[model samples]
Target: MVRPLLRQLLAMAIVGSTAGCLITDRVEFEDPENLPPLIESMAPPAAKVVRLDRTRSEDVSFACQVLDQNEEDTLDARAFLDFARDEAIRGVTEVVQSESDARRRSVTASFPPDLFARGCHVVEVDVIDGGAAGWDPGGQTRFRSVKEGVAKATATWFVLAYDSEGDPRADISLESCP
Candidate 1:
């Protein structure tokens, strides 16, 4: 059985042996007195939509965008995205490319249909912002866009608080952008 629906991806698959499989996709928010990691996403995260062109001129497009999740009016420093693999860059699609409008704070990319025809997954999404120094590692989140099969056209966004050396940390958890 299959059902069609539209919803935002605000959680991730917690990978662990003790945690077990089939984890719920939701952020464990704390209390109101506390705070959470701001999503900093301009628009709602989507299940990669296959843009259509009846005249046969459509293309697969994705905008590597960044903004002040807490304040949409503000612009983030620099952000990047990987939509082909999670571990390595195979050159099947663009890799580690900066956004188009870094100063304005976003990157809109248009690719040939063949790229989406082959399908893709998330490698990493990172932001460089001014924390304590002039530049610092902001945070990271992963995303995956399925093209075919059961989860076709669906996107999943997950959270991770790893440092520059990839060390896990505990402090904040961002659900989705405003």
Candidate 2:
């Protein structure tokens, strides 16, 4: 009789455990297709920037590639050339124009002796597009845009002079400059 009672208890426990396993409830999530089109359109639009390179040298150079919104519309090439000429007359002492083998559309302006003293300094470069011109300040150089009149994109780079001859001999240990 005890054995029969133990078997009945084990059977009751098994049935109780299996009861939970047999339960099923369906869950559903709303489809994205049901959402309004404006909800997806609220996302930010794609953005892009012009490529620029900054290098330190006793002599500096400027290189730029024409930008194109489409195959039919390209940044004016002559505008860049004119800007290069003007920069040479300004702070840039020497300028050399070269064509890149990698991209046929780029022009470079090389400066033989970059005009700046070796030290920590701020330089300004300008970005010019059509009638608007803006300046970008860099610790060592400035980028400027040179194009004027029609909306053409142009940028100028300013380089800070660094003395690569040797390590700085002296430095101030003060908490801050007065």
RMSD of each: 26.3, 16.9
lDDT by residue for model 2 (3-25), tens: 99999999999988878555568
Q: How many pairs collide in each candidate, listed in order? A: 2, 18
Off by over 4 Å in 2: 1-58, 70-104, 120-149, 156-158, 167-178
Candidate 2, number of clashes? 18
Which candidate has the top score in lDDT?
Answer: 2
- Colliding residue pairs in candidate 1: 40-69, 100-107
